[model samples]
Structures are given as structure tokens and as C-alpha cells.
Target: MDVEILARIQFAFTIAFHYIYPPLSIGLGLIMVFMEGMYIKTGNKQYEILTRFWLKIFAITFGIGVATGIIMEFEFGTNWAVYSRYVGDIFGSALAAEGLFAFGLESAFLGILLFGWNRVSPKVHFISTIGVFLGSMFSAVWIVVANSWQQTPAGYHIVGEGFNARAEVTDFWAMVFNPSSVDRIIHVWQGAFLAGAFLVLSVHAYYLLKERYVEISKKAFKIALGIATVISLTQLLSGHSSAEVVAENQPAKLAAMEGHYEESGSADLYLFGWVNDETQEVTGLKIPGGLSFMIDQDFEAPVTGLNAFPKEDRPGQVNAVFQFYHIMISIGMFLIGLTLYASYLWWKGRLFEKKWLLKIFAFSVLLPQIANQVGWFAAEMGRQPWIVYGHLRTNEGFSQEVSSNQILFSLILFLVVYAILFLLFIYSVNKKIKHGPYDEAKNPDEFLKYVS
Candidate 1:
């Protein structure tokens, strides 16, 4: 009802909507690079066709990612002026690096990747594909570094006083390589890869079911499956490593994540549970002391719980944090199981023969997206009451002059615009999938027209 709630909702809505596209772009970029590289390696026309088909999809995602992202920059100044000013010195450098090192490289090679297909040599074009992929990855690095720094503030010192106080970087590299940055970055990259790989698998699985582009779809599906399998396993490791980081640096957040209430007690890993904060109880299945073993290799090790922290400093939405975190973990484990089963079926030489498995693959694309979204929701919400860890309270960060009515109006406007953009994206991608990959053997002139 007030500016704080309205402003948080507005920014969260805008950022969450914007978040959907970047992972897709980053993930899709990796897939495109692999597809184009395969084309070059074998001089296979089918690989080229696959590369070209996905390139169109990649372009759509990249364009929308850029457009939706611009709004968040403006929102920083308009809705969170104090927060922006506080972190300006830190974010300014990171964003500048992204523009200089990441966006520039991706944008430069994009022309060669899209329009210079026939004009450039095959090797040169493949290089361009790698360039674009690396660029997207580097962009992710800077963004993650900036955000991770907020979660675990480092290399910064306070300046000024009260409302005038701000953080200025004391050590640039220390800030860049903040305690949580590397773990978070790796986790983010794996999530993005899963998002992209599942999308490719889903689309190709559909084509196979329809008996359209059967041979090409088989190749694409196999490649995506392999990627998905490897990333799913590594993602599990990354998640564990990230949890360790949280256990050490953000005990309150970790406490909230598992609904642990005792001041110094062994924490149980919940397979699934409902946290009733009123009575400080959790109901549902759990591995007793599993969390303690995971954190310290001891079943009875005492993990600092929410009771150890001041009530005002603890996360208010404990149930939401616990639920979001468990949902992410559940989806992650399911993906690992799904990809491994699909891999086993492929090894048995009956991958495509199982129509039921193919049907699951066709719909599995939503899982990774859901996991990425909820994983973020848990992380952000768990860090509640603080905009910059222990440094600044969230309530103290918003623009003082902004009104609830103004934020509400803009939020409504954003919802309308984003809905339209989402529709446009779905329609465009659907049309491309229906048309299928272009067949150079069947229509030589059409291929020529495409390259020209």
C-alpha cells in the first residue's frame, strides 16, 4: 500500500520479466555455437540447417532481452534512487566493463553471424559464433559479480553519514571477486545452459513426434540431450557449493531456507515441508540431520538457526523462502533423473521408439525455466530486510520522493507491455518451429535466397 511495497513489487515484476530472456539468450547462444561448430567440423549441410534455424530463434531472444533489460536501468534511478547512489561506484565499473568487454563483442560478431553467412569463410563464421557465445557469458559474469557483491559485500568502505552515506570501492579486484561471486556465477551459468539445452530438446522432440525433419531432429535432440545431462549433474555440485557459501556468510538466510528455528541445533534437510513460522514448526518429509551432514560432514553438528539472529533482522517470509528453495531443489533433482533416463534410453538404441519419453522431453522445457525463476526468488527473498547484506536496510533504499500511486501506475503499464512482448515472442518462435529447418537439398534456390 505504501511506497516501499509498491516500489519493491514494481522492480521485482520488471526484473523477473526481464530475467526470462537473458538466460534464454545465454543458453541459446551456447547451443548455436555448438551447432555451427558441428557444421564446420563435418561440412554437414544438416548441421548448417540446424544452425540457421536456431539462429533466428536466438536473434529473437537476444533482441527482446536487450529491450526488456533497459527498463531496469531507468527503474534504478526512478524507484530506488538511494540504493542506486549507494552502489553507483561499484555498479558503474562493473556495468562499464560489461558494455566494453561483453556487449561490444557480442554486437560486433552478430552481424557476421546473421548476415555474413555465405559472404564469410566457414572458419570465420564459426569463429563469429564462438565470439557471440563468449560475449554473452562475459556479460553474465559482470552482472553476477555486481549482484554477488551485494549479497556478500567486499572491498568497500562507508563514506558520508546517515542518508548521505554510500559505499566506495576500496579494492577493485576484491570487489570483482567477492566471496560469493565465483560460486554464484558458476551456478548461474549452469542454469542458463540447462535452460537453453532443454529448449532445443523440447523443440526437436516435438518435430520428431510430428515426423517432420526426422533425421535432423534426431541429431539436434541427441546433441541437446548430451548437454542437458552433463550440465544437470554439474549443477548439483554447484548448488552444494553455493549452499556452503551461504552457510558461512549468510547464516540467517540459510536458516530461513530450511526453516531451522533452534538457536544452535542440528538442521534437517527437508525433502518437502510446510513451515509454520507462528509456532516455529515444519511438517512433511525430511532427512533428519541431513543438512548438518551436508554442511559439516557431521550428522549432529550445530548449524546456526534463525533464533540466533535478532527477530527484526531475520527474513519475515520464512515459509516462502523455504518453499521456493525446496521447489528449486526438487526440480533440479527431477531434471537430473529425466536426462539420465533419456541418456540410458539412447544408449539402448530405442530413444525415439519410446513415444512416451519423447512426449516428456517435448514438455520438459518448462522445468528449467521454472527452476531458474524460483531459485532466484528464494535467494532474493532470503536476503530480506537488507538491500546490501548487513550494510543497508531495504526500507532505507527506495526513493524518498516517489509515491505509491506513481509506482502502481507504472507497474500496470509494464504488465501490459510485457504481456504483449511475451505473446509476440511465442508467435514468432512457433511460426519458425512450424516452418521447420530449411532444406538445401530440396530447394537450392531457397537456400541461396536465404544466404543472399
Candidate 2:
């Protein structure tokens, strides 16, 4: 194997493993805000109880997110030194904003939210929760700005000083917006909300079946489920808009996602298919002229395909991209349908009581999160060959100084560490849930038993 290719694969694997927690942090951050708001408004002990419960889960997730994210940034300067140098100016600005604006706010306010439970007034604590919520969303904004710039490559002029591409900002606002940021950000926020919402619903359903914390989990579920319903339905528009942007800006990636091997007008979207590389065609059911409408927003518009690019420049593994895209869309649609059904049942006052629906709800909770990961994988992997589409190829980004053996060694170490972390998180969360929140007790006996 080419050492560089292997390094890229290793980096991708480790980073993908690392990505699992950030969404949870982002999602649960919003959940924390809602839970605290309910506590303040209703003075309901159950809301406070649920807040502490979910906070335990959020603490574990947020810690992991911080730990793993640092490694990804570190790898940029270590394994992908060339890539780091190439987009340093652009990446630097976004990273700096994240540290200055988001990270500091979150870390500081999170302390108050966690440790100030009895130390501070309820109003002050509530405000702290709001602070961290905004900080978490701000973090997503900055991170998305950096990635979106890579996607559409804006506000930069090349300073051709070395083998690495040097990008300096030409327009700060343009860099922030790029071409895909708004749509991508909407989708991202919706996905994070979906994660938090389903988590609440899943846990609530489990508790209802077990007859544990039924009242507490139900209130939490109502807040989460209602928001999830709205976000899941609206996410479709964000997905569609982002797809249109991708089709225009990165036709090669779009073509790969659909397994469109040959240039054609009135292209049909393949719902499921396998691409024959030799024959350059996807064998699947397709809607006539659908691809044209999707890409160009015009049914008759010409939709470019892989053949439009040089054979060497086309994305490899067309079938994989197509399959990933299909899976992502299927799961997303399922979430939309599931949320609508849940909403209807919720109105009918049968959501928690119906055994069949509860079972399905429990299972379906895993899908949105699974779909989120798959959707992200499709977006990133579909953009393969080009690390910064049309500007830099992935092959050009590796550091010659880093050996494959060293990377492999580190990768294995991470697996063991992360495994331990995962176990600890689950154990602690379950412990908290089984024991119930410390504040659930009204009398002295209840408070004393769980407090310390």
C-alpha cells in the first residue's frame, strides 16, 4: 500500500471514531437548556430531576468530545502538516473564533451549571444553562464555517510560495458564509436536536416500561419529542437545499453519490443500485428526469456525471457513495414519518400507553443517530479524491515525516483508551439513572441518601 494512502485511511478511521461524541454534546446541550427552562417555569421537581440525569450523560459526552477533538486538531499539525500549512490562514481564523468565543464560554458556564446546583440561586443557574447552550451552538457555527469553506472554497487568494497551497482571506464574511454554510448548518443543528430528542424519548420509553421515573421521563420526553417533530420535518428542506448546492459546486461528488458514471441529460435518480465500473451504469429503479430536477431545480436541466471529469479525477467507489446516500435518505425519511406518527399519538394521549408504539419508538431512536452518522459519512467520503474540491487532492496533504507504523501504533492505543472511556460513561450514566437524581427527594431522608 502507498504509505500516504494508508495514512489517510488511518486518519479517517480514527477521526470518524472521534466524531461520535460532538453531536451528542451539541444535541444534549440544547436538551439541558430546555430542561432547565422547564424547571424554572414550572418549579417541577421532575424537570430538575431529568436535567441532572441528562447532564450526567452530557458530561460524559462533552468530555469525550473535548478529548477526541483535540486529537483531530493535533493530527492536522502532525500527520497532515502539509494540509494544515495549506489552509492555515483560513482554518486559523475559524479555530481561533471557536476557542475565543465558544470554548471559553462553554467551559466557564458549564462549571456553574454543574457545580452551582445548590451554591447559586435558581435564576443564576438557569442563566448559566442558557450561556452554555449558546456556547455549544456557537461552537458548531465556527466548526461549520471552517468545513464549509473547504467545501465551497471562498474568500481566499493563493500565495503560491511552496508545494502546499497557501490560502489567505479575501473577504471574511464570504469565508463565514461560503456557499453551503447556511443549509449545512441548519441540517447540522436539526441533526443534533434529533439526537437529543430521541435520546430523551428512548430513555422515557424505557422508564415507562420499567415503571421507573415515569413522571420525570415523561415531561422530558414531551419537550424533546415536540421539538424533534418540528426539526425532523424541516430538516428535509435543509437536506434538499444542501444537495442542490453540492450538485452545482461539486458535480463529481454528486455524480458519485448517485452512481452517475456517464454524462447524460434528463438523468434519473437511482433509489437503489450497484454500479458496474466497466459498463459505467447503475442497475436500479430510477425515476425519469428526477436527477435533473434535483441538481438544477429544473426537470429538463442537464445533470453532469462522472464522465464530465477526466477518468483519473473521478471519485472512486461510486457504489459505496450511492449506497451510503441511499441509507442516509431512507433513515431520514423514517425519522420524519416516525416523528409525525408520534405527534399524532401524543395528541391522542396514547404515545406512552401503546405497547406496540413504545417498542417501535425505542428501536427507532437508534436510527436518527445512525442516520446522522451515515449522512455525514456520505458527505465527507463522497468528496474524496479532493480534500478541498478543485483546490487540493487528498494525496497531496500527507506529511512525509509521519510513518505508517507510528500512526498504526497510535490508532491502536486510541481504541483501547476510547473503549475504557465508553465503558465508564455508560456505567456512570446507568448508575445515575438507576439511583435517580439527587434532588428527587422532598423530605430529609430522600435528600440525604442520594446527595453525596
Candidate 3:
């Protein structure tokens, strides 16, 4: 395989693995905030116990997320030196802000959040939880800003020439608020929320089924379900808004996403389809002119397609992009339906009675994770040959000094290490879930010592 292909795959694999935890951390952080807040508000020890239980899970995820994330920064310099240098001025500022404002705040409050239960007041501990959650959110903000800039370059100017050329920030805020940044950030946040909420729902659903922590599980499930319900619906809106941004700024990508090949045509929205790249044909169910209506609110409105761009300039893996994009969309729709149905069941007082639904909820945790992963795959792959939109080609961005053999060797090593890390994560989380929340009622003295 070519060095570019190997490098891309290596980076993609690392990022995908690293991505698993941040959403969990962010989502779980919100869950903790609510749990702790309820404990304080109502003097409910169950909420306190729930908060503490999830705090341990949150710590596990945060630790793994941080550990896995570091490698990607190193990879940028090692495998994508040119790309790094080109966007360094922009990325450097964004990353620095993330460290100073996001990671620093999160880490600083983290110790209090984890260990201050006995040492500090409940209110203070609650504040630390909020800080950590906000920190994670702000972290997502800057990172998404940086990535969105690549998708829609802004607030920068070219400097030097040839290999020496790079982008320098002209308007820092403009770069921060790049056209696609806000929409993409919102999309990412909602996705992270779903990941966290579904995990809670899954765990509690399992507990309910097992008749362990029944009351607490019911409370936790309802709380998570509310969040999942609201966020899933909002996600649809965000997804549509983000797609509109894509349509406006990256028509070729939008076209590829739907397997549209005409130079200019009303594109159909496929429910699910197989794209034949060679013949420029798609086979499967589709709503006629659905994409056209989505973009222009007119069924006859023409949207630019892959043929509108030069062959080399458009995405190479059209079918893959379409598949990933559709998968994400399909999952989003499913989540919306699931959450709504569960919410209705709760309202009807039949939520816990349905063992089958509980079983479904138990396994549904994977849906959001899958959606988050493939959504990123679609977005990044749709960008294709370009590492920085129209400004830089991915082929031109990678380190010339790196060899395919070196990338392959490192990639294999990463697979082994990450596999072990993943297994450890599952083991740790599974153990915690099985042990369940601490019974504060049974340990009144310890609970009093902390609260008092």
C-alpha cells in the first residue's frame, strides 16, 4: 500500500479509537451533574450513590480518552508533518486554548470531583462536577473548530511559497467561528450526549431486568431517557443544519454522500443503497428529489453533483462515503424512535414491565457509538483528497520522510496496544456495573461522614 493510504488508515484508526471515550466522558459528566444536583436538592442518598457510581465510570473513560488521545497529536507531526505545519498557526492556537481553558479546568476540578466527597461539602463537589462537564464541552468546542476549519477554511491567509507555504491566522475569532464550526460542534455535542445517555439507559435497563438496584435503576433510566429523547430529536435538526452547511460549502461531498453523479441534477435521498461507482448508478429505495427538497426546498432544484468537480478533486470512495453517511442517518432516526417509544412507555407506567423492551435498551448502547464513529468516517472521507478543503491536498500533506513500512509497523503496534486498552476498559466498566452503586442506607455512618 502507498504511504498516504497507510498513514490515513493509521490516523483514522487511532482517532476512531480515541473518540470512543470523550463522548462518554462528556455525556457521563452531565449525568453526574444531574445525579449530584438531585441528591443535594432532595437529600436523596440514592442520587448520591448513583453520582458516585458513575463518577468511577467517568474517571475510567476520562483516563482512557486522555491516554488514547495523546498519540494522535504525535501522529500529526510524524505522519502528517506538512499538514500540521500548514495549519499549525491555526491549530496551535485552538489546541493551546483547549489545553489552557478546557483540559486544565477539567483536570484541576477532576481531583475534587473524584476525591472531595469526604473532604468537601456536597455543594462544592457538585460545582467541581459542573466544571468538569463544562471543561469537556469547551474541549469539544476548540477541537471541532479546528477540524471544521479544515472542512471550510476561513480567517487565514497563505504565506511563503511551495513547500514553505502555510496558513496564518488573520482573524482568530473568525477562525474559531468558521462557517461550519458551530453546526458541527452542536452535532458533535448532541452525539456525545446520546452516547452517554444510552450507556446509562443500557446499564440501568440491565439492572432493572436483573432486579438489582430496581428503584435506583428506574430513576436513572428515566433521567437518561429524557435526555436521550430530547437530544435525539434535536440531533435530527442539527444533522439537517450540518448537511445544509455541507451542501453549500462542499457540494461534491454532498453529492457523493447521496451517490449523485450527474453534473447538475435533482438528487434523490436513498433510504439505503449500493453505489456503483463505475457506472455512476445507485440501486435501492429512495425518495424522489428528497435531497433537492432538503437543500433547496424545491424538488426540481438542481444540486451540483460529483461530475461538477474534476475527477481527481472529488471523493475517491464514493460508495464508502454514501454508506457511512446513510448509516449515521439511519442510526439517528432509530434512536429518535427508540427514545420516543421508551418515553411513552414510561408515561404509561409500563416501562419497567416490558422485559423485551428492557432487553432492547440493554443492547441499544452500541447504536450511538456506531453512529458517532461512522458520522466521522463519512465527514472525513467525504473531504477526500483534500486535507484542508481547497487549500491542501491530502497526498501533498503527509510526511515525505515517513515510509509505508514504518507506518505499517506503528499501525500494527497501535492495534495491539489499543485492543488491550479496550479490553481493560470493558473489564473495568463491567466490574463496576456488576458491583452496582454503593448502598448508602446500609453504610449510614460513612454516608453521614461525607455529607456532614
Candidate 4:
């Protein structure tokens, strides 16, 4: 196989697997804060128990996310030597900011939030949990800002000889607010919220099915479901706005998504289909004028079709974009449906009473995960052929000095290392969850200054 293809596959494989943890951790970080916050506000033992239970899971995900992410950093140097040399100056700054803004805050407070539970006062512990939550989110902001620059290069000028087009940050703030930043950030944050929310609901649902921690799990399910509903809805809106940006800035991608070919009135949106370049149309269910309306806010608006772009400029990986987009929308819709149903059950005071639904929820907690993964695939794959959008192609991003053999070796090494880390993470998390908080080595106030 070709080296570029191997590099792409290797990066995507590792990143996709690694991606699961960060969002889960980010989302769970919020849940940790909320649960602990509730315990503080209400002085409720149930909320405290809930906080203890989920914290184990949070730790598991955080460890895996960090471990997996470290590989990507190395891969940038090993696999994409050329690409790194070109964009390193600009990219390095964002990574550094992430360390400062996100990692700094999270790591600083994490000690207090975790091991300090009994070592500090309730109020102090609660504050530490909140810090962890903010730090996780802050980390997200800098990371997204960096990725945003790749999608829509800004605050930078292209320089250097014909061999490499070096990207340098011209205006720091402008780089942060690239044209696609808001839409991408909102969508990403919402997805993280859903991941966290669904995880809470799913685990609680499992306990509900077993009739364990009945009242407490019920409370968690209601809170998580409610949050999931709101964020899922907002995700839909953000997706719409994001698509609009793609339409204006990356029309070829939009055309590939819609399977539009030939200049036609009122572009149609394919619900599900296979776009055959040879036949020049999608073979499946489609919505007439939906494409045009989505893109231009008018049913009769003109949309550039795939025919308009030369083969070289056209987004080559159309099939992946089409499938991933469909999966993303479908999953988002399902989340809305599930959240609404859960809300109704909660309102009726019959949420946990419905064991069948709880069983479904037990397995469905991973759905947002699927949507999150596919949505990400669509976003990244949709930008195909370009590492820095219009500025440079991905093939051109590699370092001439790097060898495929080295990348292959690193890829194998990454797989082995990640496998071991993941197993340990799962073991530690399950062990902690199973142990429960009913009995602890010390009092909950051991770290807390609270005197009861």
C-alpha cells in the first residue's frame, strides 16, 4: 500500500480509538462537578454516593485519553515529518496553550478532587471538582482553536520557497476565532455534553435494571437525560450553522455530501444513497430542495455540483463523507428521540419502573459515542486532500526525510502500548465501581474540614 494511505489510516485508527476517552472525560468532568456540587448544596448522601460512583469511571477515561493522545503528538513528528516542519510553529503554539489553559487548571485541581476527598472540607472539595471541570473544558477550547486554524487558516501568512509553505501566527486572537471556530466548538462541546450525559444515564439505567441504588440512580438518570436532550437539540442547530460554513467555504465538499452533479435547480438532499460518479446521481432516498434550503436558505438557490469542480480539486473521499454525515444526523436524531422519551418517563414518575427501557438505555449509552465518532469522521474526512484547507494538500504536508518503515514501526508500537493501557484502565475502573462507597477506609470528611 502507498505510504500516504498507510499514514492516513494509521492516524485515523489511533485517533478514532483515542478520541473516545477525551470527550467522555470532558463530559464526565462536568457530571463530577454537578454531582459533587449537588451534594454540597443539598447535603444529600445520595448525591455524594453518586459522585463517588462516577468518579471512578471519570478517572478511567481520563487516563486512557491522555495516554492515547500522547501517541498523536509523536506521530506528528514520526509520520508527518514534512507536515510538521511546515505547520509546527503555528500548531506548536496551540498545543502549548492547551498545556497552559486546559492541562494546567485540570491537573492543579485534580489532586484535591480525587485523593483529597477526605483530606479537605466539603466546600473545598466541591471547588476542586469545579476546577477540574473548567480545566477539561478549557483544554477543549485551545485544542479546537488549533484544529480550527487547520480548517480555515487565519491570522497567518504563507511564506518560504516553493518546497514548503510555512504558516505563522499573524494575530493570535484571529487564529482562535477562525471562520469555522464557533460552529465547530459548539458542535464539539454539545457532543461532549451528550457523551457525559448518556454515560450517566446508561450506568444509572443498568443499576435501575438491577434495582440497585434505586432512588439515587433515578435522580442521576433524570438529570443526565434532561441535559442530554438540551445539548442534542443545540447540536442540531450547531450542525446547521457548521454546514452553512462548509457550503460557503468548501462547496466541493457540500456537493460530494449531497451527491449533487450537474448544474440543477433546487438541489436535493440524499437521505441514504450511493453516489456513483459514473452515473452522476445518488441511488437511494433523497429530499428535493432540501440541499438548496440547507445551504442557501432557499429551495431554489443554486448549488455547485460535483461536475463544477475538476477531479483534482474535488473532495476525493466523497463516500466516507456521505456515509459519516448520514450516520451523524441519524444518531443525533435518535439521541433527541431518546432524551425526549426519557424526559417524559421522568415527568411521569415511571422512569425506573420501565425495565425494558432501562435495558435499552444500558446499551444505548454508547450511541452518542458512535455519533461522536462518525460526526468527527465526517468533519475531518470532509476536509480531505487539504491539510491546511486551500493552502496545502495533505500529500504535500509530509517531511521528505521520513521513511515509511519508521512510521510502520511506530504504528505497531502504538498499538501494543495502547492495548496494555486500555486493559489496565478498564480493570481499574470496574474494580472501583464494583467496590462502591457504602464502605470506605476513612470517613468522607477525612480530607474535608467539615465537622459533623
Candidate 5:
């Protein structure tokens, strides 16, 4: 339509496409650390095989992740120059830290971890594995810190006047540990863990179904399942904590998330609902006063509603916000059940024999990706009209110099290029998985392997 909408769509498309790889890379990085560590600890050649196999997959994800990510950074200046200028001081520091501390560190050790498998000492390689994992995680930490600061707007003040004003950091540490950062980071990492584990589980489960690489698949499946079980529970706690923070810091967003329109003594948590904004009512199931209990641990406790906010200041996407939030939560609950059920089967020593469950796990790989995306959509959309939350409205964020035609042209190019990249990524990964890991045993004398 117009330049702003075109700009928003282009950014949204690029970012959404770019998001798939980072969580996959981050999740896959954690799995690599565990698989490599196990190889070092148990002196098992199978663990070594697993590590090498997944390392190749991780490399693919990391390379594409880095490539696709660069576009978004440039888009900031090209499409949203005003927003870039406004948050330049604060945002620049976060990006600089990410480049220096996260990307630099990860790249340094990634070479050792990926290429030094046959060349370096086992202990050194193990250390490299740990380093890569930490570096990837640190990358996520800084990025989330920057985004969370946008959500909560802490540790900063505006300078100058009107359109020329910019945010300046008052306290570096406060900027890093802003009110929502810790909770958001925890939620993000746990979600990333799920994404990675489910992927491993999906592939291994397929191998079991086809009766290929039986032993290797069994071990990998077990490891992934264990990770999935623990993190599924952790997400419940983390999601609760994150929501409470939203309630405290962003009452209007919380209100929109729950489809609560009236200012009242207590709010109900809708398990599934459709919000008809014009009528100011929600239709579907809800737990009476559940929102109050969730936030304050009291059924009668007051919870703020959209009515409390001025009409001009309210989130414009109330229905979308409610649906995304509920969908994310619903998928989360299903994951908890799936993991618990799988754990029960593992405890009974028959997890591998359950082909039906294996089939489900094979498809469930899409769940974490879905949850991560929708959860993000809820958070961002609920903060609607505000690119920098309380400080800057999104309408004021665009590059006034950019025209609709220019954005449309760039958007078309981005879609075409991203489509080609997506297809190539899929093909490369499928080829790797189909080829699988080599079945060679490592010679102890040749490798100097030891159990620690």
C-alpha cells in the first residue's frame, strides 16, 4: 500500500525468514556440545559419530543464519533510518557487544570444533565445543537484551527534541539487565533448546521407523528426549514468570493478550477465545479469575484491562495478540504432555518400541518453531504502535526519504533471494541427513582418547 506498510512487511518477511535459522543454530549448538562432551566422557566412537554428524548440520545452519541476518541490519538504515537514528546510541552498543563478544568468540572456536576433529587433541576439541556453545548463547543474550530493552524501555533517556531526539544509556549494566531481559532471555533459550532437541528427535525417530542406523538413532533419541522433557517443564515456569513481568510492566499488553476489555476487580484467563473488539467481549472457554491467580496468585486480585489505557494508546491488534498468545501457550502445554508421556515410556524401558509415538515425535519438530514464532508475534504485536515502546511510536520510525516503489522493489528482491536460499538450505540438509555419519571406529592409539 504505502511506504510504511511496505517497509513493515519487508522487514517482517525478512526477519521471520531469518529467525528460523538462529534458533536452529542455537539449539543445534547446544546439542553438539552435549554429543561431543559425551564422546569425550565415555570414549564411545558412536558419540563421536553423532557429534561429527550434527556438527555438519550446525555449520549449515550457522552459515545461513549469519548470511540472512546481515540483510536485516542494513534494512534498518534503508527502510527505518529515523528509528535507527533514534535508538542509535543504545542499540549500537548492544550490536557492538554482540559482534565483539558473541560473534567473534563463536567464530574463533568454531573452526577448531568443526575442522580440528582429526587434527587436534581430544581435550582441546572438547573445550572448543563448549566455547562454541557458550558463544552462540552469548550471541542470543545480547540480541535479546537489545529487544527486551525495546519492550520495557529501561536504563535510557531521550535527548534533543521531537524527531531529532535519541535514546542515551544512563547505566550500562542497567541497560544489560533491564527489567524484562532476564525473563525474556530464559524463555528464548529454553525455546531454542526445544527447537534443537525436537529436530534431533525427529530425525532419529525417522531412522528408527525405517530401521536404519538403529543403535545410533536410539542413543540420539534418548538424549534429545531427556533434553525435551526437562526444557518443556522449564518453559512452563519461564512462561509464567515472563507473563508476570508483562503484567507488571506492560499492563495494556497483558490485557490485550487475555482479551480482557473491562476494567474490573479480577480478570479471567481465556483458554481459547475469539475477541470481538467492537463488542468488547470474548467468546469461548476461560478459567474464572485465572488471570488474577496467574499474576498475583489470588483469584480476587485486580488485573488491569484495555479500558484502563487511552483509546489512542491501545494496541491495534487485540485479536491477533490474543490468538498468538493463546496458541503459543496451547502448543507449550501439548509439548509438556508429549515429553512427559515419552519420559514415562523411557522409564518403562520401551520407548524405542513405540512406533506410534515415534511417528508423532517425527512431526512434532514443527511445534517449537511454531511456538517460538507465535510467542514472538504476541509480544511484539501487543506492544503495537510503539517501535521503542513508551518512547517512540512506530508511525514516526520510518525513513521519510524511502518511497513505496523503492521498498516494494527491495521487498521483491528479498523474497526471491530468500526463497532460493531456503530451497538450497533444505536440499543441503536433506543430502547430509541422507548420507548420515560414517561407520568407522576410532583407533585409541591413533587418537589418544581418554575417559575423564
Candidate 6:
């Protein structure tokens, strides 16, 4: 209803919609590198075919990612000019580095990766694929660094008074590798890999079900399964490490995430719970001393609670943080189980034969995407009130010149345009999938080899 709330919702909705494609692109980019490299090393035609098929998907996703991302940059000046000005000195350099080291490298070689198959040598094309993957990752690194610095506020200092104050970088490298950057980056990328792997697995499962591209589907599924299993295990570690970092650097956020409202010697981890902010109570299934063990490896060690901090300093959205975090963790555990189950079936040579499992895999493509979004919400929502942790309150970050009607008007337009884009993207990707990877002109024996 109000300007600030409407602006926040508008930004949140647009960012969430835009968020769908980038992780898909990043994850798909890495998968492209792996699949293409396998083709070069093993001289397998199926690997080459798989690479080409997924490359089309990656290109579409990347295009949408770039297009949607530009809107967020514009929103900064339009809706959150004050916040932009305050952090502009730090964000400017990080964004500039992304343009130089990440976007430039990815864009320059992306043409070669997409169309240079027949024009360039195999080795050169393979190198280009690697470059694109690295570039995508580098892009994530700088963006995460800038964001993590906001969470931790390192290597910066305020240089003015009241509304004129802004953060200026004291050490660029320190800002880049701020306390939470490494852990958060690794966690983010692992999640991206899961998204990519799930997409490949889902499409391949569909092919297997339809009895088309059997051999190629099997190969791709196997590759994706391997990556999924390994990454799931690593994600467990990364989540734990990132939580520890949060506990140390953002104790109030940590408290809100677990719905711990009172100071105690040990904290319980909720398996499922509802936080009643009005009553200051958490009601649900919880494991005794679980939070303590998770953070300190001891059941009795102290874990800070929301009540330990002043009411002014605590996160405003305690219930949202708790719910989002638990749901994300639950989905993560389910994914790990599914991956391990699939791996077992594959090992037993029963994977393709199991129609039930194939159906599950087909739908499970969306689970990782859901988990990624919820995890993002947990992190951002948990940091409520503070746009830049201790330095900046979110209420102070809005543009003084912006009006509710203006934001409301733009938000409606964004929804309409994004809806069209989403429909078009699905149609284009589905058409490609239905067409399959066989090109008769390029490979004369394609139909006879796979379709037959």
C-alpha cells in the first residue's frame, strides 16, 4: 500500500522472476564444458550431440538472464537511489570487474561456442566452451563478493554525515574476499550445479521414457547423475560452513533463522516449525541441542538467540526467515536422497527400467530451482532492516523522489512483459526438445543410428 513496501515487493518479484534463468545458465554452462570436454577426450559422437543440444538451452537461458538482469540495475536508481548512492563506490568497481573479466570473456567466446563448430578446430572450440564456463563463474564471483560485503561490511568506511553519507572502499581485495564470500560463493555455485544437472537429467529421462535417443540419453543421464551426487555431498559441507560464518558474523540473523527467541545454553534445530512473533514462541518439531551441535560440534555449547539482541537490532521478518530456511533445507535433504537413490538404481542396471523413478526424475527438475529461490529468500529476509548489515537500515535506503503510484505502474508492466517472455522461453525450449538432437544434413546416419 505504501511506497516503501510496494517498492520492495516490486523489486522482490522482478528479481525472483529474473533469478530463475541465471543459475540455470551458470549450471548449464558448466555442464556444457564437461560434456564437450568429454567429447574431445573420448571421441564419442553422443557426447558431441549432447553438448550441442544443451548448448541451445544454455544460450536461450543466458540471453534471458542478461535481459532480465539489466532491469535490476535500472531499479537501483529509480527506486532505491539512496541505497545505490551509499554503496555505489563499492558496487561500481565490482560491477566494472564483472563487465571486464566475466562478461567480456563469456560474450567474446560464446559466438564461437555456438556457431564455430564447423568453422574452428575441435580443440579451439573446446577451449571456447571452457572459457564460457569460467566466465559465467567469474561473473557470479564478483556479484557475490559485492553482496557478501553488504552482509559483512568489510573494507569500507562511511565518508559523510546523515543523508550524504556513503561507503568508500579502503581495500578492494579485502572487499572482494570479505569474510563470507568464499563460503557463500561455493554454496551458491553448488546449488547452480544442482539446477543444471537436474535439467539434464529431466530431459534425458523424458527421452528414455519416449524410447527416443536412447544411447545419448543414457550417456547424458549418467554424466548428470555423477555430478549431482558429488555436488549434493559438497553442498552439505558448504551449508554447514556458511552457517558457522553466519553465526559468527550475523548472530541476530542466525537467531531468526532458527526461531530461537530466548538466550540459552543450547539451541534446538527445528525439523518443522512456525514462529509466532506475537507470542515470541516457536512451536514445531525440533531436535534438542541440534543447533548447538551444528554450530559448535557440541550439544551444550551456547548459540545466540533473538532475545540476546535488542529489539531494534533483530530481523523484522523472523517467521519468514525460519520458514524459508527450513523448507530449503528440507528440499536439499530430499534432493540428496533422490540423487543417491538414482545412483543406486543406475549401479544396479535398473535405472532405465524403472518407470516410477523416471517419472519422479522428470518432475524433480523443478525442485532444485525451488530450493535455490527459497534459500535466497532466507538469506535476504534474514538480513531484514539492515540493507548493509550494521551500517544501513533498509527503511533509509528508498529514493525520496519515488512515489507509490509510479512503482505500482512499473510493477504491473514488468509482470506483463515477464509473463510473455516466460511463455516464449518455454515454447522455444520445448520445440527444440521435441525436435531432438539429430541433424540429418550434418550426420547422415543420425536417424538410422538413434531413431531406428
RMSD in Å for model 3:
2.5
TM-score of each: 0.97, 0.94, 0.97, 0.94, 0.96, 0.98
Question: Which segments of model 5 are wrong by more than 4 Å?
Answer: 439-452
In candidate 1, what are the lDDT values of residues 1-452, reduced to their tens digit?
99999998988888888888889988988888788889888987778888888988999999999999999999999999999999999999899999999999999998998888889998999899999999999999999999999999999899988788999999999999999999999999999999999999999989888887788888889899999999999999999999999999999999999999999999999999999999999998999999999999999999999999999899999999999999999999999999999999899998999999899989999999989999999999999889999988999999999889999999999999999999999999999888777632346554543331
- Ranking of models by lDDT: 3, 1, 6, 5, 4, 2
Clashing pairs in 6: none
> How big is the RMSD of model 2?
2.7
How much lDDT does candidate 2 score?
A: 0.80
* Residue 136's lDDT in candidate 3: 99
Comparing 3 with 4 on TM-score, the higher-scoring candidate is 3
**What is the model-wide C-alpha lDDT for candidate 1?**
0.92
Q: Any idea how many clashes model 4 has?
A: 10
Q: Which stretches of candidate 6 lie over 4 Å from their true place?
A: 439-441
**lDDT tens digits, residues 217-314, model 5?**
88889888899999999999999999999998889999999998888669998999999999999999999999999888999899989998888788
**Cα-based lDDT for every prediction:** 0.92, 0.80, 0.93, 0.80, 0.89, 0.90
What TM-score does candidate 3 reach?
A: 0.97
- Best candidate (score: lDDT): 3
User: Once model 5 is optimally superposed onto the true structure by TM-score, how far is the C-alpha of residue 215 displaced, in angstroms?
Assistant: 0.7
**Which prediction has more favorable TM-score, 4 or 5?**
5
**Model with the higher lDDT, candidate 1 or 3:** 3
Q: Which residue runs does candidate 4 get wrong by more than 4 Å?
A: 263-265, 436-452
lDDT of 4 by residue, 217-298 (tens): 7778777887888888888999999989888888777777777876555789878888777777678898888889887778
| Candidate with the larger TM-score of 1 and 2 | 1
Give the range of the ten consecutive residues with the poorest summed lDDT in model 5: 443-452
True lDDT of residue 442, candidate 6: 66
